[model samples]
Target: MKSKLSWFSVPYVIWMAIVVVVPILIMAVYSVTTAEGALTGENFVGMGDYAGVFLRSFRLAIIATLVCLLIGYPVSYWMAKEGLRFQRVAMALIMLPMWMNFLLRTYSWMSILENHGLLNQFFQKVGIIGLYNSLTGQSIEYFTMLRTPGAVVLGMVYNYLPFMILPIYSVILKLDVSLLEAAQDLGASGAQVFRKVILPLSLPGVLSGVTMVFVPSVSTFAISRLLGGGTQMMLGDLIEQQFLGGAYNPHLGAAISMVMMVIVVVCMAVMNHFGEGEEQAVML
Candidate 1:
């Protein structure tokens, strides 16, 4: 049995080596070497020049994650508390956007948010923009949502909000009803039951959702390119520019990727550390 199981693991091991380990090893080597194949630290050293880009990427990712949390948590909780048919319908609606091509969905957002796009046109037709102009003493024709940092964040939130909702909803839905009953029997109010019981128990899902949302948001290139109009350059854009765009520097791109991987790993580790401590405290 052991021999057979070990034989079965061989295929997976080979797959991991080819797909994951080999690429990482190659990236590590490239990150530390120049185009001439000479080892150098300049790749990492030059990252300081793009500190503002790094900060902006993180700031936007954080905001998007927070917005997803604020919106998704309530929706998840509501879905979990609803009837089975309602939950199914809500889940279908939530997942409907994901069935479409990712780029198509983002492109649709571009159309909706452009200067004379559907949203502004509707607002103008309804006199909402005029009402705002009257109140603010200005003659702005179109709301400038596109080609801005907020547009990038909006794209991130729209694309990744489902990731946040699914994990949290699954966690909340699986919670034992008896636990809530016991809490209530012990004189806990509705808010207290949630704060003390549901909130603590559901934190793992929140952590998972945050990781899912933040990682992609931080590294997203297409959304920033389309929505930010090249104004907001995230790490992904910078890396792409080095490797694929006019910069054409694979070593620097690898260095940026490695550094980003390290930073994300460290941030996630720290976040998990605190989350675990909180979970443990709740357990105690």
Candidate 2:
């Protein structure tokens, strides 16, 4: 029976080998070897050149993940407690925008945030711009959010919010109501019950959500590029430059990827410690 089940997995195993394993092996080869194909440790040494990019990526990813958690947790918790109909409506409201392509959505923000964009025009027409201009004694065309790290963080939070929400929501949905009632019987107030029971039980979901958001946010290129105006180069931008941009250095790109992979693995390990191996349903 085991052998029969093993045969059924052949297709998926082959697919992983072709798509996942092959690319990883290729990256590993390039990560250690120079252009002339000589085996060397130079690639690892070169990573030092991009240290700032690595730091920026992690910083922005952490910021975005924390913001998502702060915003998403209460909303998800509320939804988890709501009636089924309200929950569906609220979830739909949160997710409807995600139906569109993420690139398209980000590009749309450019029109709203750019200098001389609709937002600026609205402020100008509403007289707020005039009031500010008079107070500052200067003419301002727009409030520009583009080309800023904060804008990049906002974009990341927008795109990845759903990933953070779903995991926590799933965990909350399955929370045992009896535990809450028991805590209440033991003289626990709402705050005490939440602190002692609800919050502790929700740790697994929170950890899963953080891992989901942070990994993608750290590795994302599109949001950083478009919102950050190609100026705020994070780790993803550095890797893209090596592989696809003017640099055209696959070896360097592979080295960056390896370092990033290691960082991600370390972060996951730390989160798993918090979770106590309690992660459920969320994909890594």
Report the error of model 2 at residue 148, Å.
0.6
The lDDT leader among the candidates is: 1
RMSD of each: 2.0, 2.5
The model with the greatest TM-score is: 1
> In model 1, what is the error at residue 20, expressed in angstroms?
1.2
lDDT (Cα atoms) of all candidates against the true structure? 0.94, 0.89
Report the C-alpha displacement of residue 150, candidate 2, in angstroms: 1.1
What TM-score fits each model?
Answer: 0.95, 0.93
Against the hidden true structure, what lDDT does model 2 obtain?
0.89
Residue 2, model 1: Cα distance from true site in angstroms: 5.8
Clash totals, every prediction? 0, 0
> Residue-wise lDDT of candidate 2 within 11-38, one digit each (tens)?
9999999999999999999999999999
Q: Which lDDT tens digits does candidate 1 get at residues 185-207?
A: 99999999999999988898899
